[model samples]
Target: MECVWTRNGSRCGEAASRRCDRCRAVGYCSLSHQVSHRSIHKIECDRFRRQMNRADVLSDFPFTFYVEPSKVQVVSFEKRCSFLARHGVHGLGMWICECSCGSSLINFDTISFIPDWLLSSELCPCNEPSISLQGRLSSWKDYCEWRHLPLSSPAAVILHWPLTVYWAIQLATGCNLLPEIKNELRIHYLGPEKELLQLAAFGELQALFPGVRIYIDFVGPAIPDRRSDERIDLHSYALCNDTACRCKTEMVSKSQAVRMQLHAGFYHDRYGEFSK
Candidate 1:
């Protein structure tokens, strides 16, 4: 993947001269760019090191797939605030999740206010909020602080497909893929989903990538309730050992990921209290 440079709203690369000697990750067309970029580069370089060390942090299991953001799309202050204010009545909003993978994931209807996690992330992009995700104004002429600081809870949902689906769909479409993937990663693959949120993400991806096939087996004990939220009440000791069976062969990998469809109605809460 080639690194393309965008400056002054125009992209230029391949012809650029100076490059970052540290990771050899970025390039500059002039000395001014190098100097101006140093502050951003210092943090980026440290983040790069942490990403490299992620694998060293003890693994609970071998990774089967991993998905990350392809691009950083910024929504303006007006757009973000308006969206949130309108949607607040429903306790829904979107926030940015800057994945360790060097991409930013847009999480919609997520329950958060300041998105402090994003602010604390190494991928915050800039120290000031004026430079919001979309490169819009950092300081509000009226309020005086960084634009993002004064902003109330997020208004619009930052829709995001499951990390798994994000990668799967990209691999399938090829053209719709994120530019960062083409430039940075040599091999981008989708791993298995264990958490319910991850599984939901997979379901969304499946909807998007209709062409891709997924094989699931009824390995867990049969539960009378197929409801998605009912999963929490299901037996926790379920296990499957039929390695020679066709189901095992069809699955992404025997121990890679687990899949169990939950009934709908997960978005709403019912039966206010415990019923006999």
Candidate 2:
């Protein structure tokens, strides 16, 4: 980790030996910088602390990932990064935007103007429709009943990518798209990456927009040449722990709710084709 405090448009960048006493998520090279950055850091520090202390942060799941003994319980993105670093894998796409070189700005190190959509834990199926969420969400218990997933499932950690896009759509359309565009929904999901591998995560979108024919265009360089411009159809809801709910008869006859197409190029390079 490196010092988060910036000096003269440049980061201190020195090895951060001192961490914020309250949140412990941010660090500084020295006591002086820590004190100097306190006023600015206080707002986010409080938020980080509150999120870290939430009851759901320490949630355990039935998955083998959680069943195995871990040195530390994976909670916040900061500790999650540290845990992954121990195994020689950098935690990309968590607490920071994915990049080829390295992370900056919205990265966990600085925490400046970090997107609340990525951090908010209250984006669940709750009582307050106006303040929390609309009927777009199914209860965690209900979701688990269908999915056989635990209520406190850590799947959110991985599912945040597509969820963020859904959140952005809500913000962009003033959350009125449900009534405005009812049957067919086309989402141009730009800059796709690891999402290309785990298409099942998009299944959650069905819950978000029930009975809607959702077409997703995953346009990015991550798509291999062999797979580009190929349309893959998802015939049924994502598979769950329950095999009794499905049978060979149903699997072969099901129609797709979510349809995906891969385009292996940067959006800018393929703008001519997409513009049409």
Top candidate on TM-score is 2
Off by over 4 Å in 1: 1-79, 89-157, 160-202, 211-276
lDDT of each: 0.29, 0.51
lDDT of residue 216 for candidate 2 = 85
Candidate 2 per-residue lDDT, tens place, 1-276, comes to: 678786554567789999988877778899999998887687668756754554352243222233323322244333555544443334333323322333433322222111111211232221111232244332334333344444444454445555555555554465343346567778887776556544655655665655667888888766776777777666543443323433212331223357788777655345446546
How many pairs of residues collide in each model? 16, 0
Best by lDDT: 2
Give RMSD to native, each candidate.
22.9, 14.9
Displacement of the residue 39 alpha carbon in candidate 1, Å: 30
Per-residue lDDT tens digits for candidate 1, residues 62-155, read 1111221111223333344444334332221112232222113333223112211112112111122233233221122211122232222121
- Where does candidate 2 have its weakest 10-residue lDDT segment? 111-120
